[model samples]
Target: NIINARLRGKPGLFRVALNGERIAAIVPQTDVVAPAKGNDLDAGQNLVVAPFVEPHIHLDATLTAGEPKWNMSGTLFEGIERWSERKEITTHDDIKTRAKKTIGMLVDHGIQHVRTHVDVTDPKLTALKAMVEVRDEVRELIDLQIVAFPQEGIESYANGRALMTEAVAIGADVVGGIPHFENTRDQGVSSVKFLMDLAERTGCLVDVHCDETDDPQSRFLEVLAEEARVRGMGARVTASHTVAMGSYDNAY
Candidate 1:
């Protein structure tokens, strides 16, 4: 238990009890001091909060500002273009080294959990393999969730389906797709269905990069949502970077 804890944005001293790592109870402070116990902590009016959670991050591409070439345009496609070149020259050790350093910074800032999307578009699966190793290596320091993300496209890229299958067979905790990046709208819908079906077959979570483009016409989010709702798997699915939602018309 932590006594004399100051509640954030609240006027009061409180006592926080724990059931293992989770908070079991919290009550207003009564006594000036808590009884001496080896396990108990005295917060001394300091604010306490649970460690931060990083829901979306790309550990594979972290700490690479201008390695191969600069993304002078600062657009998503440009970033992907730079990363494609970077991935070509990046070795396994280089990926692991960069990912570990990035995780170290997250840990120092009180982030205890992280979900990193490792690109699996490459037929070689260089990033996914390297991140899988780093996930196990940093398990003691933080909880790492590795998603097999197809950065380029599922149907647009060559041998995309096979690479995704191999990624999950290896150690990917989640299945990912970039629907907006597909060349055609039909292919985007098919990619969403394919990724959802793959997750079900492999018993993995889904975290798709859906509707990342600024085009309001990109309505793949509906397909993804309907797929999850129809299958009763909404809790196991996530749609990240839905930037098009903001540009969408109010009437629709």
Candidate 2:
């Protein structure tokens, strides 16, 4: 029940209401309000605003800054190499421990949604399994989306195709690929086709690490966009780290 309706001028100054939730019925001179329940805010100095949203993050790779060695080159490839070495040492417990820590940080920052990629090329599938468990563990506080990423390369890595399929079977929400790292252009194109087909088969979203290089010749993003258009999976697909787009000269 609203007790006092106060208007200071001809139009309005400030109006306050109290029902299930207290709200400002009219605009206030200052962007401040009295504190309410559940807020750890000071009485009259706090301001009530909408909740926050953080859409993208890699929970699995986060917080593993340096283990065996550090990324000396400061390049993405160096980071991948460091991660690959680290992945070899990753146990289920290690992934879970780091993922939980990362999620805790996200919650503290008021982030409610996240999209993380788990490397599926590892035969053990430790990272994928751990993230799936973490998703359940933090469901009350955060929404998690896990992508089964063939980080090494779908065809280039041994049994990568099977690993990706198994990841999807085990509840990965998205299928991923790295086309530029494939052995040849044909392999790159085929990987995208294969990933799209897998997404169709498993009903998962598609995200690709495409053309993340400084070379002007990288054109897999066009291929990905074309395939997405043909398959009618436009926004369902996300092409990440297309830094090569800054150098491409040709259209198509």
TM-score of each: 0.88, 0.82
**What would the C-alpha RMSD of candidate 2 be, to one decimal place?**
5.1
Worst 10 residues of 1 by lDDT: 28-37
lDDT of 2 by residue, 1-252 (tens): 222223433332232443445564544434334445564223232233334665456677888888778898899889989999988888888888888888888777767878888889898888898999988988998788899998889989999899999999999999999999888889999999999999988889988889988979888998999999998999899999899988877664
User: How accurate locally is residue 242 in candidate 1, as Cα lDDT from 0 to 100?
Assistant: 94
Residue pairs with clashing backbones, model 1? none
TM accuracy, model 1: 0.88
